[model samples]
Target: MNRREVLAGAGTAAITSLAGCGGVSGLFARPTPEGVYVPDHVEGMEMVGTATLGDVRVGLTYSYPHRFWTVERDGDGYGTSRVDIADDDTVHLMAVPWDPETELVLPNTGLSVAIRTQGELVSQEVIYPMLSQRMGFHYGANFPLDGDGTYEVTVSVGGLSIPRYGGYEGRFDGAAEATIPFEFSADALSAIPYRQLDERRFQPGAVDPMSMDAVPTGVAPDPLPGSQLGRGTSGDAVFLGSVVTADRFGPDPYLAVSARTPYNGLVIPGAGLSASVEGSGPVRLDAAIDPELGFHYGRAVPGLTPASDVEVAVDVPPQVARHVGYETAFLEMPSFTLDAE
Candidate 1:
């Protein structure tokens, strides 16, 4: 896990649709179970602080591998107010509820949360990746990640008058820096076996080590469009489409990604696709990352605004420049949905 290589922000793919307006009441609404909401505290790990305001209860916990912390409402399903650590120095908040009253982030990340209240002083501190930028009552920023040091990251949700952090270390992968900020969750626990991505998700071959070009390596994609990446002979999981196998790391961390220009930015990110980690869990769609890009601005399309609609994911992990559009475009595959049995 290389944090600096892929610390990302929300993708602004759909900025134009919102006319560059995000965090508005209905600018980017999503579906959720309707009810009078009340926040809940999570149990386990190191409980930091808990506070309740305007019917909203918030708490913090210290997270490490093998520990669990969750957040829930009186009647809401359970999850956690979690900070997750990726392979590198990348850090993220998880299971944080998205309030309709809050504003939207368009398509900045694979997922986006809204702050619903402007003068509403809601604040949460995080681990790695400094956050320090705010747009109006909305907040967001990009922080860099390094696989080295330990650091502090704080995320405060107040008015957009306050700023969210941005680009921690200018987005570089495999950087040797100590960047321990945010918290940690399950995703930060381990390399989730492909099969366990979902329930009843079946797959063949090794986890994160599928075959491509009739060779063995990372989630290998088909060399030719019609080729096969894996054969699901072990269980039921299938390698939906081409996969990105092997990563050649480097100095010019972010360079260029192009499908037409082979080898330079070669990666197959099967979109809408799914793969199960054979023996353990459900099928989940994943794309191989470019260690160079390091999940920062490599995929940044100029002019992308705050309201662009993008996939529901953590900040885009960094990849060298070679990761730019190759996955999103070239390896266009169907998303893998959990076939719960």
Candidate 2:
């Protein structure tokens, strides 16, 4: 089978698995938990849970409409559509230690985190203190609410030894767990700006074609074909040049290219961009903006070899949106490679 077909089959398999884990029906079926803590003092993120594991403190922060994952659906009679699902409402878990003088964050290698929901566990991406925000070293990942209910979050830290300072040293070799509850409301999801971009294209002054009322109530229709979802940030003044590659995309491989537009100084998800690889197979692909990732990506490229020459070209077209806060911009997607891992 061709590469696209392989990705389609894999996506179909994924949809089948997601169906049992509360795909669309979960939106209305789950009830909000009682006395949900809306902690105003913790950097605007609602503190879901926190625990003291040894001498270190680990905390979790969650928000809505944060990250997204999408699935492709086969159409019965109508044409196929890429069905977008907001699986990852953003989640951030941070770790810090108490000290007589100040808080000391741990090295990224010192700790790891994972969350359990609906019997599935996903590992969090560990960010070192220096790379992430100051004093906010974290193990972070976004989660899709399978159904309204509590999820078990586990923060595991291995034996970590800190150097002696002022007559004291520290170490942690345990795990902490917390139960986090969620309320899934289609109404609340409707308020997010990007949710409006789920299925439709951007047009000036045009009404959103996929209203919340139009969303499926029973089983979600098959995700539309070639749908893309991602998240990224460039603020409103900086342009970031980026490149990404994948060793595999379900028996196949991929090379994605993207760059931030000077207009608005950001990468706009859902915008269609063109890409090409210059090497054997010389694949030419279209990269789609994934607003959830805030970047454009090409997930399935055919016949990519590790020895392929390192040249990826991306063409980002000018975007003009008078209604929204955007205008025409251009991008110079940088060149990069990903060694097999």
Candidate 3:
């Protein structure tokens, strides 16, 4: 079987295990059921530190080098390939940035990292926004580090590229940087829990996302305000639609669709989406950030009634990169009609 098939199966099996149980809690809980299949449960990560850059608060952390995948546009959808751990790979570096005021994790922020020691550059690369069984949505990548010592890690965050709404206007529009010291050693890296699944390793289930005290997992707001259109699933990702009339969205009634992972509800950004009402033809939905809606795709529609037949299509899948559990999902998505119940 291909890698995606293997991971999907594994996730299914893991999630099924949580059927009757009260549901596991804690950061290191095993067999953590998720919406998608994930490989094994990785242990904790050592927080390198956190810094404030512009309107974003970035938290840096590290764990054992992990094998992940890189995403690329594949025809109308997307594709992914495994990126195995290199022989010299030292740690899987992660940068989690969020809006401090809103306390929401920021996606598509164009994040990059540069590691240095003794005034010399050690490693640098533009990290990918990833979803993991441990950390739901964050920017991360594996890096080869020099032998154990204190290193100055500088994280650079770029401006907001997507449309902003509500209180998010005119914010996160400037580039910012921050530096923090990280002490790395072989012993420290080895101490982080690393377990390989046996019978359930390749099963069709996913472990639950770990509880992180340092950084909040980027999740879409539940109970999205406005008249509820309905909920549906496409390509294992859940989509929820609602209609709201607001001055910010102009005179037309706005149709908002929140696309997220199934169980964890993490936001899926960088997607090309379109919607049609009562077979009124497709209308492009722009990626938007709002105070109440969080991250969603929406547009102002002239006539949207509660009984309107709405169909939302994933014209292009999410453009963000993926970790093990999410590599195969959010692609090959079919259109789903929104039930205005």
Candidate 4:
């Protein structure tokens, strides 16, 4: 079987086992009292609102306060630890930023949110870029509200630190903010669907991403534009390589690599990457967005040919927080050689 088929089969088997009661060991058969671990599945969250800010469309959602994990730098690699929900935690706020045209979720956006009532700031925080089984990739954090009342949520999106290409050039560079009013009440928060898994509460696999009404679930597009080089996997993150020549990217050939999650094809951003062509030395690839390629890492390579032997190295793993099934992957990725088409 092909690599993608193998990955799909493995994921399916694991998820099936997780849904059953027979395969889980005694250690993980029960749910944790505190801290974050894998769960069977989380139901869909209710949308707070959505607004357009420059090139980005931000959607906000909320769920019951959750105990989640955070990723931090650890030596040469990275590490994950739990963030307990505080006693005063009222809701888990999530922000999803995406390209308005393509609906592809944007990463490394450096999102910050402020909650206010009666023109007085109540709470504020810089949310974490995170991954989850249901939400895919988004910016989220636990927050305490000022009880039930009318509140104004101001979401501020910072400039894109990564490079931009194609129609994305010079865009998302300036910070933009949007405020949406919301009615917060215990009745509305309690109405959100919440379900606990029976035996799969702490199992090894992930549930499917939740289908929201108008929000993008962070999935990358398949069959990317340009000449297909081939596909490879590193650290359970799938990488698709392609070459494209465009007037916007200059005269040389541009190499684009799209990194994504395995089954769901959610874009993985905020990674440091480099590419080498025919042992000609490494070229640092900048995390970029394009009209056709979506979210990818790319750099112009002079004298790039179809026969060039290309290798991609992950200098830094995705610097975003992970939910459960994703925490173990996208770290410790090995450099992989692309098979030229």
TM-score to native of every candidate shown: 0.18, 0.31, 0.86, 0.85
1 or 3, greater by lDDT:
3
How much lDDT does candidate 2 score?
0.32
Write candidate 1's Cα lDDT for 1-341 as tens digits. 21111122223443233222211111234332222111111112232233322211222222222111222222332222322222232222222111122211111112122221223322233322111100001112212333333334332332121111132122212111121134334344232211112221121111121212211111222232211222211111122222222223222211112111122211222122222332323233233233222111122222222222222221122121111011111111232322212
Q: Give candidate 1's error at residue 341 in angstroms.
A: 27
Per-candidate clashes come to 94, 21, 17, 0
lDDT of 2 by residue, 1-341 (tens): 22223224445655455432322212222232211111111112334555566555555444332211121222421111222323454333333333212333333225455666667874444432211111122343344455554566666555443222122333343443334444444333333222212222232212211212211111111111122112222222122222334222345554444433222122233233433344543344443322122223454655544444444333332221111112111122233332222
Residue-level lDDT of model 3, residues 1-341, one tens digit each, is: 22223334457655454332211111125552333675644456788999999899999998766666677866755687767667677888999999888788888789999999998999999988887766877898888888999899999999988889878989999999999999988877766655555566435566777777767787787777888899888988888899989887889999999998886787888789999899988999998888889889999998896668899999888777677667677778899998754
Ranking by TM-score: 3, 4, 2, 1
Ranking by lDDT: 3, 4, 2, 1
Q: List where candidate 3 sits over 4 angstroms from the true fold.
A: 1-35, 75-77, 195-205
- Winner by TM-score between candidate 4 and candidate 1: 4
TM-score between candidate 3 and the true structure: 0.86
Reference-based lDDT, each prediction: 0.22, 0.32, 0.78, 0.77
Model 4, poorest ten-residue lDDT window?
Answer: 18-27
Runs in model 2 lying further than 4 Å from the true structure: 1-43, 64-103, 118-136, 173-341
Off by over 4 Å in 1: 1-56, 59-89, 95-143, 159-341
Query: How well does candidate 2 score on lDDT at residue 88?
Result: 54
